[model samples]
Target: MNRRLLLLVPLVSALSFAAVTRVEITERGDVLQGAAFGPAGAYERVAGKVYFAVDPKLAPNRIIADIDLAPRNAEGKVEFSADLYMLRPREAAKGNGTALVEISNRGGKGLLGMFDLAAGSSDPRAPADFGDDFLLEQGFTLVWIGWEFDVPPGPRLMHLYAPVATDNGKPITGLVRSEWEGDKRVTTISLGDRNQVAYPLADPNAPENRMYVRDTVAGERRTIARDKWTFSDATHVTMESGFEPGKIYEVVYQAKDPVLAGLGPAAVRDLASYLKFGGAETPLSDEQKTTKRALAFGVSQSGRFLRTFLYDGFNQDEKNRRVFDGVWAHVAGAGRGSFNARFAQPSRDGHPFLNVAYPVDLAPFTDDDGLLKKAAQANVVPKIFYSNGSYEYWGRSASLIHTTQDGKQDAAIARDTRIYFFAGSQHGNGSIPPRSVEAQNQASVNDYRDSMRALLVAMQAWLKDGTEPPTSEYPRIGKDQLVAASALAFPKLADLHLPRIKREAYRLDFSVEPPRVGAAFPTLVPQVDLDGNETSGIKMPEIAVPLASNTGWNLRSKTIGAPDELYSMVGSWIPFPVNRTERENRRDPRMSIEERYKSKRDYLELITAAAQKLVSRGLLLDRDVAKLRDRAAKEWEYALKLN
Candidate 1:
């Protein structure tokens, strides 16, 4: 192994444009017990902290919300630090010359699970955790740097340690809102999203602190009696009468000392810059520094982070150099999150029935104005892939990214950009043998990760040799593939209720106690075939040759209440009857599984053929065909034995 001495030495350095001041290596260990991955050989895990000091005066730094108000050192540079972790080939020269950085999603690692098909692990140390080592075998260096400040603290989780913003050394106070929908009766809940740290309550007895509850996303808010609930602590609230299931509760309280959260994007930009362009003192040898290009991958909340990052002009470093050569933002829809505003909450995301509404899904839904304007002006526009799933169309107002502002026509895609919709899939990649919990129906089990693997390769090829990838494959208004919810022509299936309601993205005004909601933007969904499968977008083999009706919208189960509301981030899978007799007995409109295929072998063959079409079109890799067929075989068995 060509390990360097920097692992054992403390190093302090400053990049030409970035603010990375020092790197402290706290631990180093062999990955997968020193298992070798193809020609890349053995890999190791490097974990530590990365310290930064940014000059608030720089034009690039000035955009960071409250950076000027943050505490600065003697040199007038604001100081902060973040947790860092990397998985690289032991012999750096043996790896691909590109760094694949996965912005940690809520302080957790997901790249291995998404790309490598590995079981998720916050601290991946076992062989199962590495899975097939697809990423390692490809020789790409994997990197993660904590960029979220409010992520719940666990020993294995990554975190950004940022300084608070103040007004002339005095505490700055503002109204902070936290909201949640109760799944079950509960007396207490934390103020932070998923129990991460919340801003400290400024004045506990402030009469301005108010609580409101509603039954639905658009329902009227009713104030709870002031004597009914009390703040258990700065972080939690308690009610004498337990919060009812299916009700949304929101609290508005005055909080002080907001963190300069916009620095998260700067951290991402700086790390990419530092890796591509080395600093005055460096840990990597010249040969080890073979990473000439950087690619960023972020999913869900982190995906929205990338969109906001680009919109905020963080792609260009202080040196006016492009940070990432390519970026893949998966399942982000057209939304940007609360990533860069005063008193921003990075974890607060907009969803159908989950985080109802915020600054997310705001104006400039298309790329015309707010998204790419700054990047285009700076000429730092990286190749971008806005990949979403079917759920995004129904639950995330994803059509806004491709359609006109009025949803009347298709918007022109940028030359350097591509948009892909994973047909019949959910927000998160689905699982086999679909399970149901909060959703009314069986959850969608359309696995789209195999297709994602193909897209990643295509992205690399596009960057490497200028090879054009498969053209954007999303529903278009001009093609009649996208339609309004009211125009949907769904087949009547027994015991199945089609959801006619859609989540609207309303213009919000947060200047008052309760935000004044304004006119809603038009959002459309993809047209569906007879089987209730999406007609447009990249379809996996299971979607193209299926045994069930896979839909991207699922209603909340009666057990969780609000049965009329769409379950957050969930999709539904309604299996076809096993035979014609069963289909007739159930009064099903769609063809039965047995009617579609003569036998399991026939089903497998059809699955293979469907996969081959995608492989030929560069939407799926050839190696994944066998697995798709295997999964189809299981579906065949599961359908036949259905009671």
Candidate 2:
């Protein structure tokens, strides 16, 4: 038998129980033909399924929503399983002691691309998939075990197979709400969020089942005739004339058998605990018996999952040990998501022109009440980095994380936490050769992954050693860098208009259908300079050099149903005219690109200075400066070509 396989023998008695009951290794092989990566040496991929069993009566598992309602095993424990994919050093001792765990975003891996500057791939195997071998070269073991129950099923996609909750051998029923907003008209739509598996309608003709449509996010919901639409099946609704484009549609119906969606967080907590504090039957080689620490990275949906996970108190393991030592939630904004509630839809997220009012964007936004209160109480608060982008400020109420509930002042941040705002960027990385889709302006393309890479290193340093990460960098009301959306003073450049409206967070009461929207928590955006670039936060070379205005908010296109509404998670990039004459002809208020820079070489020089400034502050890596210099040259050409 292989030496590594022999190490799986249990060290404890078989009667003993652990949160991670079994780990089934379905596939194991060398990665990239055993390509060596720095001191970490060759990497190996381990893909499999992990089975979990948690005693519902235990404090850690008891906190899970609907845990008591879930069916129990013969041992009086709830059982679940999840897909697992991990990358580790072939030789156990060669790896970094930290296990970097990425809570899969929508069932696929993202950190490889986010930090390594590589292309997206679900099953990373090829040379390009490793993406410059950034994580491997750092000697960190990469781990991903599915924690979301509703991720769309496909090959290479990670998922959680959680059992449905029941009420004493009978199915539990609750109201499930599904919402959708799209640019193209469609005759049919799934009852799930973003087309994941939907909870089947309990009674198609139930009097409580209702459908509503609205042109804008806050517009009055007009009821659609019950006869106008019908449940095509358990998972879909069919409209005879087709749902209108750019309009919001919602359906609320009775759904039976709520999956113990809360178990998703438990799945993460258990797996991380196993890696850091393993039981008898283990997966690690003898040389790598237990990981010293575990760090978590989650983006967008998964990012919000981390916030919710902390808020819900899943960081404490079954044995009351802390799960993650450090957590980096990127672009999650200030939302906690419907991850652990009754009939929760893990895929639903809040946006300006998309999913409007869900359980997301709730009250107790800042650490004073919601986010870290439970963790602080349990003394399990992990070193946290809440990183957001410009889009999150405008679309996700990200300011709520650091600002007062009223958004009037900056709240004191916890000593263990850091919040960073990526100025003049979007939800994810901006697209290159920026193009407008359904938005009114060209989409933002200011890549901030370079800064994100530096933050990951900073997180590890803070976790492993006592090295303090960079101070929090975000716009503050006290500094006059953050202001009300209505108070924005953007220059009127050619074909560019700041969004008239933005997404706002409200105190929502979900006891009633359609939710009772209470007093709104104030939201603010970063103030802009005379050139229309954001004034505060980490300004990447693109923002600091000023070839164009990159804004967090973009209005919907006129062709769409709501022209004045802010497009969901999209930012605007309006390039300046090439020369003074072109600027004069367009009557643009912003300075011309030629007038701003003496030449392309001068522009590149300024870009370098901007990158170096961030590196000095630990907001950017010195190694990324050269790559930013090369990208600036191409952007310079693209700016001039617009003329």
Candidate 3:
């Protein structure tokens, strides 16, 4: 933690549970409209925006963040505060003591809260959330906080109101870079896509407000005069010649004001602490007050937030107590959030055209190790489960989390940490529909829902009874499973283009007093087999019993940027036709569905056996055996039904 932050922790009054002055947020009782699209059962949904104030003497760290573009809060020691939005079972008895806090993804998305907990909510752009009563079934209280600074304010969108860092009464200014890429001839573009907040140009007409354009991420680059682009609005820049498709554009200019973006991690840490321990004003129920252990799960961007939260020493609260007893970082490869820096954009995912230099994938692959180390703990480090997918190994720098810094060796994961790779799966894909369109670039068959379900059970048991969960299942450098994207080759399917943008990680240095931007380190990716499937990691029955080519890297849609540079997070699923003759005509080096299995019966038999193997190994639960077999049966029915 920074020296300034250290001072606040000591002065903070002991508050365990969060004290909320609840203000109702919705007119209807159900935020997702009735029990039809919301938490099921007799459970009634009552939501309120919870407000709290933090003493600036202790909360001042978030007020003086070392970043450009932060708003001004001149007073050194006033109450720095924020609000939390929540949806819970109106009756306390409906929820178990367990609370699952969700870190909103970019655009104020509660990826896990809506997708997994609620089960049916898929639109990240909007919060028309519905679910299969997953969390309510288990009785886990759902909590969400607005950690990122730039999320636009909207109905049903999660957000935060953090103070900006200022020097005296004047706004601090610094050099900031804004990069973008588009497949269209747009008249203007904001520094951000979802949020319109633009970096104020130091001088709107300054010749130095320069722009550069490139045909490809690495292709030829040429300069465009300042007149070609102008700051049309506070943060939006308009182009005179319009942007070309499959090109990259960037502007480097002076940007003023930086917010104490570090407050994000503080909010997470403190919130968990308050909820678990007890806050002064929080209406802690008799059951809520007795809360013993708190577990946090974040998907993708939020997962990155959890990893960074631990790294920044926020895990230890104001009372020097552990905030979360366990953390599940889902699909958050080897990177930490680009949080808490000058002009920090927590949403940037290191896309080449924009946000190439954000500080990501730093150190600490394990709970007890990395660039940011934890204060010595009384108990053992938090039990962590690093849930990753094909995308992390492909482009998200996930390899850096498991392998040695040099990429030649495997970093010994702590016994407390468990890593699982959803074999033949994409970043966000769980299961595909009965029949997928080949033209849509649908992901391969990998029903990880059962695996995810089983994993959650195992995590709970492990935390409660010290039960040893399934051992780590990931590409191992010691086994020659972790390799470069260029190291593997797949079938020559016409619709699929191999991944060209292998955005690996590096040994980054953001240790400056104010921290620095841009990272260029030596990083590596995992290797795959002849089937284009990862050789190691948890192999779902579908991948182990092959029907389609499934790999982490998938090409971008034609409408997007270069189709060759693997699409963002989504993976590819190219199925083999039922006829061997059809496969032979295409000259596909791989076997067809017919050649792989004699009949639908043969495939079902194989899939059943594969599921059994996983269950015995503890990678899956016995309850999931039926679910896997049923999915296989459905797929077989679909293939044979066509005949």
Candidate 4:
């Protein structure tokens, strides 16, 4: 089957609806400096912010979204808008006709920046601008957009500027609460946490503004006088009393302008449609041959956005055509985006101290069943590839999506969907390389990059070629594989503070639609294996072979936030001894490295077999085998030296 022959014709007729203006900034072989970018002179390093405006009528459901909230845009007309940046091949004939859209994760920091650096390692700083030339090498149209309205502005960050709901153009004021944790006795603080822009009050010192202090989640909410907190600035609230470390302080103040936050979904929908089919209201690429299809990818926060985007039925554009042919959601767990609603906290996530559940990751995963009921929309579901790590099982409700609502029977995944589980890996395991020797207390050295790349190829082949990828690979509830955290028979590691509680999913009460605040319900977590590692999922060599006990849950940084509780999006890496005698001496219930493999060759051989098995099953890619084999050799050397 020829690659070009595999792609289905565009569902909607292509028109010059160029919604974006292109500004070619630089070429790869141009003035970009020292072997600047490893381009073969086929692509241009372009930079431009694509702007878009969505019609409310076109998005009839977005104004209210899934939540049954009163429309904030009193005029019933929303000024919803967002921006995006792109990188593309210079010539139409030089590249594949596929766009890889990335849902920006915390302004694109962490994971990819460290693990997937661009050619020649350009931009060696935070919020890396380039990747391992992986996307470029595939001749893909790489793009990023600002879906989060609350994220602080910075280099290459995407943002959304929306309108607050109005009652006859009158400001809608409500009790909006914000929380923060700090160690130093700071007399001042931002009203919102983590650089989030807070809602402005009609009057700073108004009697309605209030503050409270607490040491724990259950601590009594003691009221602080109006004089203690003053609106030092427009959106910033100040505290006279110093806030102590490891304690949480909250403020509920009057704020105005509740942007129809739900329009967020519409923004993603419109932008994707404009790029894939060309109807943007600006100049665009004449290379229609390479701009005919779309494949969206997101990690962690962005991954959650994909889920929410789908739940809200935003994959279908105004024309009732699919916006994305395929979507790759990584480490999103079983959760959806905290998007769409008045004062929506898109970044709140699932941690206990942070935002509790707010109708996210709800509904069964197998169907367009619960989220959208429209018959036409039901049949328009796109092909999806959801990849998550062990951290999701421990922190994000991973099992709930694939199992019965009560967390018992396994749910049948839709054939269009493939839920992959990367065992013993953290939320976004900081890197994609092999294990290092210098770091003693390091994260799980399980690399998912190569596998992810391989799966991406499989996804494209499936979407364009009418081929079926491998079946879903995740822990199952039917088998003893998926057990509750309470049943984990973990080896006793000295001084390691294990979590008694994990991030739970709740049935929050959104009684008031205008401002969807809520009370909490009971929570659920995934079951684990005897070694404390999640089983029956896609196992990397690190987890399949013996070396250390890697888990997705990590202890909170005691210096800030809720002390001793599970941290956000990070996992723990606990290593083992050389042999069984060493393990028994320390009272470790698990076997040591020596017991698992007799010699260095023995370990390498095991890793080779494991990698081959995963590759055969399509869990691991053949291209990645060499790296795993090399890692095994390195680990064996470390074992020999350490023992």
Candidate 5:
């Protein structure tokens, strides 16, 4: 065995499980809300008996809802099961009202129901009984509901029920909303779409066509903004909508393209300003401009802030692009009450991060990238930065590391950043991997999971602390070199370039590119038995006396080939101190592994010739090459010495 491999195996075995740990904490609660659209006085309805329960089986204590949905055909035939665990709030000042509902079936199932214990109300109301046909017409299957009363800080109980037929089909999907106190209460909502019926009378895309507004002071429903198109294009739309101290106003959005919806009434005014003075070439109409200005004025008077922004895949169609851009603008603009923009280009050398399974190399050109750049330019560095996978259905494991590195290098960043890489995570968790027999084994999937977790941990540390990260490594070649270290070896920055102005965009400055050079190869002398088979024994090659004096051996390179693969052979020397005055003073590239071995026979012949010449001249002294060769030969003999 190679000497280095012998040294590494024992160390790896010793350190394999050094950092594994197990710990547990109680699971927290999550808030739920009714669908945005429906009838007036609409509240999230629950059926059957729903009670909160704590589970000891799950780690980090889990708080779940035990629901009993009766027999489908018979009334009161109860079916009991626990659906989701509630998460704790990040801050107490923000109130314990905010909650994260663990989506059942990985968010494939819709929310069953929401109970308002704070309202001190147990009365139940169905969508059909309410005097609102709009809820049915608009296909508002689920509504996120919150209460007006203040419940004491601690574990609380509520009840909910799911309609019998709803479970037979696809699961419902929507956002979870949490309410804060005071006239400027903050409302947090999560939004998504799900289909439960095969074909409904209303547009199947009704969820996208509707928007909801709430009166913070009165705690009453305001209005629903309907789009002209059958579907809404925006995804992850976050808007800061509330009233200020002395100003009574509502934020709203209007539908532009039959498919695209504008900001609601409460947000229209500022949205309009964004479309105008925001430097966008495609400005909004005069009406929009006026509305946005008024909203801005109201916001200033009330001492309240609002902003909005959008996120979408850059390569998506125009419809998706608009939706993403609009959502990002709404969220970023509303949250910050101002605009900011930034840019980042994350690329690894040789495109090594772009493996066939996941290609993150193309992300810089996507909508997320563009939106971030725009926000940075506007001086709004968003708290949350969103990015999608480059390949249609693959993990961004490799690309994420490089991108994080690039983000760190970006000069415009003013605050720390957090990156979320979802697990079993293929292209934002929507694309599912085909279930194969091989996938049934947990070990088969461990590597991907471990890699993702490590990446996230590293990212968090980089953001929370000011530490730079070490380059990512991958297993290749041999056990000793299991984790091949990665580095930006190439000096040239062909892939790295600065943005250019209009007409001169095609030009590049070559003077800034780093220089490259040919490398030397190492010598390898294989030890074999009489059968000529390469046995499990190896040794360093003998050094030529004169050559040894000029260039001592590099032990690290001797054991392992050059960490950088630019070089070809092992122990092949290159000319040093080349004359800068001469243009043609370059050395030949090192020989390949195969050629080195092939030339070994000739090398031995030269050594023999040198040895014979020295002996004949009576110059074979203690400093002779023959003696050095003899010593190396002895080392090899001892290395191959068998028991």
Candidate 6:
């Protein structure tokens, strides 16, 4: 009974494992799609034959199949057959190709074997070498296992070669490998760690390193070429050329540095400093020194490599002038005349009238004197020089405008350089003069606005296409236009009574006192009309209108029903001096006591509750207008009581 049972068991087992198994592989987009046997008992019924189909859309010309088996399975014990067809096409057979089959024990313990298929005939290939001797011959140290290929321009044949260990011996996988589309053959042997692998693309023949350097200060530039031999240690030495003696030059360099093998720590530090401070002589703190030193090193190296002169220390006045000379010479040598356009004006008459309203108070916003010189050398010419009304305002109110001479250093600018003054306007407020008393009164505001617009238009035409402007129609009383005459009108320039400071002097020794309250106002009040006719008229104080309602006194308008002889009193009562003579003489406290008392009385009446409400709305705040009115009253009373 036992013998019979054993025979039946063998038969049953063979029959169970003999049935065919079906496998499917599908690919979608860049992701792989497929299914495998489950870990449970689902795959226990698998047999010797397997079949898989490829998605027709995949356009796959080859298929790779991996097979896994149990350890008890002997070598060559399992045989398999496969048939492939396109499901969508519904075709039985479209083409024929070779198939490669490899076999190994479940744990990879058995000898590796392969079979090559062609024309329906199966033939065994040699065993794999496992050492991959074919890759070694190609100067590749096999660090990993993978393959890369470049498709040829046209269809060609090529083979993937590798070695595998076999029980009998080692054999090359290329014995059965084949493919179409031949291109340049380049084999890359990957190492065990991908990071350790070196690719042929990094070879020097691929692309040589090259860069350019620009010396902005010296206005020079150069290009550098690099190759393997050129970049070797002591190979990539940087050098400067085309430098003129006695001329300061600005140099800049740029290059790519490898993290592992590029510039050393010291080189890096020096380069960093050069870029930061541009070689300033001013003493730097420890932190600043370190930073500047590093930047300099970088900039210097880049400048040297690009053959550009160092730009460091070229921003200083003396040094910058030298650099500018060098730069201009280069520009001239290249036959470029309009390379730069900076210039300076000497006196008001030598400058253009249009630029006069820009206000000297704006000078602080401009580049330092050194940079200005460089700009001039480069051909920069100022079209206008604007000054403000008085000294109690911003400092930049005294700028002079000028144009460069045809060809002379530091010569007075041409008459084409305009000079304009903002009458009753202070500092930058001249650009958009206010009509409020807190600013300039309305009539003065209108005059400044109209004049500035006209000047700008003239300048635009001059710069855009060289169109000359007609004589400026500045606001004038008789034949003379209003101008800023003293420190009161242009605070930046010292007062006439004050001593002048030489430009070359390094230190100022004079004591500066704060302007005293009720200090005399500067600037001359016009005494005639535009038509040159002498007129006696009353000057009114600018009035504040009610915010909620427009009805109120228009202080700027002429007042009627007052005695004509009283007009002089109106002019005399002004808080600030009205005429140049009065301005100069009013330093004495007793010149106009009656006028001061009358002005205070009038101011008190003007700042009523109704007036306060109106002014608060316009000024964007709710505050007591009486405060200013009371303050003005006190000042007027004090001036009147002065001996």
What is the TM-score of candidate 2?
0.97
lDDT of 3 at 84: 55
Q: Per-prediction TM-score, please? A: 0.97, 0.97, 0.84, 0.84, 0.21, 0.20
Global fold similarity of model 4 (TM-score): 0.84
Question: What is the per-residue lDDT of model 3 for residues 367-451, given as tens digits with 9 covering 90 to 100?
Answer: 5455335534434258889988777777677777777766677778776788888877766654545224222376545657667
Worst 10 residues of 6 by lDDT: 330-339
- List candidate 1 stretches off by more than 4 Å: 1-17, 280-288
Location of the lowest summed lDDT over 10 successive residues in candidate 2? 7-16
Can you write out model 4's per-residue Cα lDDT over 445-506, one digit (the tens) per residue? 65666677678778877877778888888877677667677766665577677777776665
How far is 279's C-alpha from truth in model 2 (Å)?
3.4
How far in Å is the alpha carbon of 482 misplaced in model 2? Answer: 0.5
lDDT leaderboard ranking: 1, 2, 3, 4, 5, 6
What tens-digit string does per-residue lDDT give for candidate 5 at 150-181? 11122222212222222334332322211111
- The superposed Cα distance between candidate 5 and the true structure at residue 568, in angstroms, equals 40
Candidate 1 lDDT, tens digit per residue, 1-643?
2444654442234332358877788888888788899998998888888888888898888889988789989999999889988898887788877899998899999999999898999888988888878899988889999899999879779899998999999999999998888689999988888767898899879988999999888889999988999999988899978988898999999988899998889888888888888754555543236788899999989999989988889998988888999988899887889998888988888877777867788778666755888888888999999999988888888999988788898988888899999999988877767875677788988999889999988998898888999999999888789999987777788878788676788889988856888888899998998888889999898899988888889998899888888888889888988889988998988898878988888888888999999999999888888988888787677766764
Better structure of 3 and 4 per TM-score: 3
Pull out the clashing pairs in model 1: none
* lDDT by residue for model 6 (1-643), tens: 6743443333223222111113222211110111111121110011111221111122110111111110112332222222111101001011011000111111011111100101110111121322211111111110100011111121111111111122233221110000111011222211101111111112223233333333221124344444212222211222233222212111111211111100111112121222223333333322222221110100111111111111112122212221111110000000001001111010100001111111111111122322144344434323322222221111211211111111111123334433233323221121112233311112121112222323333443453455664432122323333222222121111111211210010111112111012211122222222211112111111222100100001121122211111110001112333333554564522223333324545546664443354343232112324444544355444333432
Worst 10 residues of 4 by lDDT: 3-12
Regions more than 4 Å wrong, model 4: 1-41, 59-81, 109-131, 163-169, 182-185, 218-220, 225-227, 279-284, 357-369, 372-378, 430-442, 512-530, 557-563, 633-643
